[model samples]
Target chain A: MTSSSVPKRSRSAMDASAAATQALYGASDPGLRIRSIVFRSALLLSMTVALIAIIGIISWAVVEGGQRLSLGLLTNNPSSFRPETAGYRPAILGSFQIIAGVIALIIPLGVGAALYLEQFANKQRWYNRAIELNIQNLAGVPSIVFGILGLAFIVRGPLDMGFIAAAGSATIALLVLPTVILASREAIKAVPPSLLEGAMALGVTRWQAVWKMVLPAAAPGMLTGIILAVARAIGEAAPLLLVGAATFVTFDPNFWEGGYSALPVMIYQYAGRPQDEFHVLAAAGVLVMLGLVVVVNSVAVWLRAKYERTW
Target chain B: MKELGKEKLMAESASTKEEVFSLDGVNVYYGDSLAVKDVSFPIYKNEITSLIGPSGCGKSTILRSLNRMNDLIPGARVEGDLQYHGADIYGSDIDPVQVRKIIGMVFQKPNPFPKSIYENVAFGPQTLGMKGNLDDIVEEALVGAALWDEVKDRLKDNAFGMSGGQQQRLCIARTIAVKPDVILMDEPCSALDPVSTYKIEDLMMKLKEDYTIVIVTHNMQQAARVADKTAFFTVSSNDEEGSRTGVLVEFDETGKIFSNPADQRTQDYVTGRFG
Candidate 1:
């Protein structure tokens, strides 16, 4: 009834309305557009800077030591007297043994600690809160502090494990243990709580539910963390120095006893030398260490992509 | 026709039916706050009891207490008597695991383990160490949930690959795999489409022949469609303290509650006037 009585807009009024609509949809503020562009460029610049630094180091190492990358570099033992024929057999073996020990130590201890904290510990309790805070703090502590701890407690004071590859392994394990635990806790926390409830609703005990459902679901993420932590342990030289990774270990290192020389430690030793040949050898060692870390990290990324649950 | 038959059966059994759960003056609390206060109701055996309410009305809390699922939450406590059969479910000697084995639950969301279809169903029977052929048990549970025909060809396929409704049905199959006497469904079809919801409703009707079901539903029509008895819950607020608590306003046969409710609040709720 009111529609018939309603007055229509004048021609000029309709034209002005169309003009206002045009103005509303025309363009964003120029200042806002410039601000967005600036923000994006800043992010791109930061990422490019990091990428360039990594590529620069890698390329420099290849240029300096490209010719020296041979089977002999892996086969022949290091010799200060003959840098031309020198290799890193003993150091490679030592690094392998130390890393093997580190893997054996960290996997069980770190995963168990993470499970206890994530699945069982009550956050309301003061002690559990304290433990959580302590772990986060430990991850931030310098790697060299763990070296000092390993030297004082493990090498000399309590366990009395002398200068051996086992000492180096234990030291490096301690250095990366916090990282493994933190990553594992994060992985466990990422698993949906609904899965746990679903399992428990079927009459399984909490432990059964965790072991059967939670662990398997979180396995890929936990493994990614473990692999990254192991990579970090492999590259450690500061902690191993205090734990007795000898500079010029001629023989292959034993796990429990005898002098050890990891790849990074050997690189550090060669880089410290005055001879130009040893410097080349050190650059070549850097390539080998970088290759090993790259391989381990690749496995972690592959495992994550292949198994991570989207739900 | 099916609805008429179900209603007829319900009316015939109204007098002779046994009570599966009897709650008297139950109060549920989370830490220092009382979430649900003085709720009393009876859930009959071999019947689908629907608890209908708006969000945050403690229907889910009361449902979780049936199988002691709330024990998983720290500082959550239940007071007063909740009797399952003749025994107190929260007795000092009663084990929560055992309680859950007999009274399984299906959650609001379909949460299947990241495993094969067969493995998801088999997990329950394997955990309980049930004496039977594992394959047969998995098949039976799947068939019971009305999913065997669709999933039989892909028993080994991962459960996550299925559609959302299929996944929810798989969850239901998982619950029934251990042969529980009672199943608590917490809005099992809330995440499903209309067709899937109808499929589940039909499945629930068939399941009540063997297992008792108590469902918490937000959909009033769903409660009227499949539930034999309906319990209406509403949130009550204290003006002085500004604290909200869920209270059971009415409980009766589904038809009566929807058609002619006793309480004004239940009338308001069922007619979509207020919640």
Candidate 2:
């Protein structure tokens, strides 16, 4: 309606209408504000709790073992009677050797399994579904159960490789294989289906498309997964203990047929002893293990940042 | 509607042009349900044939089936005669890979590999073992797509760094690097802006000199601008069975399909009366 054709209201009525409109678009109720604040605080509190636990553990290790952190910790060999001069030379070498083996075993096996499942397997088949279900379940199985299997299969029965660094590597690799496969599958799945179709439309066979385009696109993520899985394998002590990461070894580990000691197994042995000095040595071992894991995880983060694709 | 389309096709068959693809009573199915029913048409050599329709009318399905891209989806099946150069593409002995090598596709979205622009173009020729200087092939394909000048200095850069239109053109470059006879594009310009769309339409016009193109598009004006022939599809739903099937209402020269359509549905669609 035109302005001149409309009736004009009194000043009091106009004032009342203006006030109603103002109130209609005014600030939200106090209940909503309080609820929003509570939700945000809860989220912050959850993050704080996780951060505190990690920081607390790192600080505790530093306080308990800072005095023992020296060049001697890396150079000298372990001594049972003399904890003062003892170091993690053999244990450090042993951890590296087993990890190398684990990398060799897991890269081909884990990536191969993930590729088979993600790219080739028909989801309509019952067995492929069963295999996927089993791999997921395997990731959740206790690490000690893997130790038992390793003892029965690799160390003593069937393959009979004996208690050496190779056996320890095989056991830890088996324990982390499920994690690697799951992560690799996620990375492969993250590559767009359109990319595959684009490649196929160009006349490449399925394998060539996967090997050339799909794998390179998925490499950074797969590498990140491998590094994370290796980190988890590094800190595992229970399975290695059963697979024979010995309590004490003076010399460097032989990959094939000699005694070896991983950092975590040595730490566990030291913590079980009666001396306070040995407990400090155990804490020092924890520091070394934590450093290795942090370095590996940093590599993963850098690779992801460098190569992740937006489209 | 079906009879009118057939009559038009019969009249067009009097021409001496070679047919690259000939479909008769083609029916596409996903599982037991028919998705597109009785699609009959001829795609001639070096011609741009556009499929135009509203949503859920199986336009993309028909385009994808031309290159056997629908085989990638589980339970998707095609029936009736679909011949590529007088041979049944679906014959038991014909390898789908071989069929795809002859018929390449461009998708609705630009899906370049997460690699350098040079690598993206080089991948197809390298995989197919095409004998040539690799650099020259990539440069030629980029030139053919009208992208070489903008990207030649930055061939080593990642394909993802380009603009949307540039990336789509790079996808076109990658497809043509394989040297396929037919290129099937599924709504290639729907994801682009107006300028990019027209650029692609212009590219399509130039490309028709070398390649037989069958494009599915929601833009009717695009068909009018670049297409030599047009096929109009509409959805026919059965309320009792709760099913919708795509039916070809008309097929003719691009001029007649847009200006003087035979079927009422085609007339209404071209005039924007209703989808």
Instruction: Choose the strongest candidate by lDDT.
Output: 1
- Fraction of true A-B contacts recovered by candidate 1: 0.91
lDDT (tens digit, per residue) of candidate 2 on A1-311 = 66556556655576787789879998568999899999999999999999999999899899998889998998889999899999999988999999999999999999999999999998889999999999999999999999999999999999999999999999999999999999999999999989889999998888998998788878889999999999998899999988889547999889998889998888888888899999899898889999999999999999999988766
Candidate 2's C-alpha runs over 4 A off are A1-24, B1-15
Query: Residue-wise lDDT of candidate 1 within A218-293, one digit each (tens)?
Result: 8899999999999998898888899899558888777888788999989988888899998999899999999999
**What TM value does chain B of candidate 1 have?**
0.94
Error of 1 at A137 (Å): 1.1
DockQ for all models: 0.72, 0.69
Please report the candidate that would top DockQ against the real structure. 1
Q: Could you tell me which residue pairs clash in candidate 1?
A: none
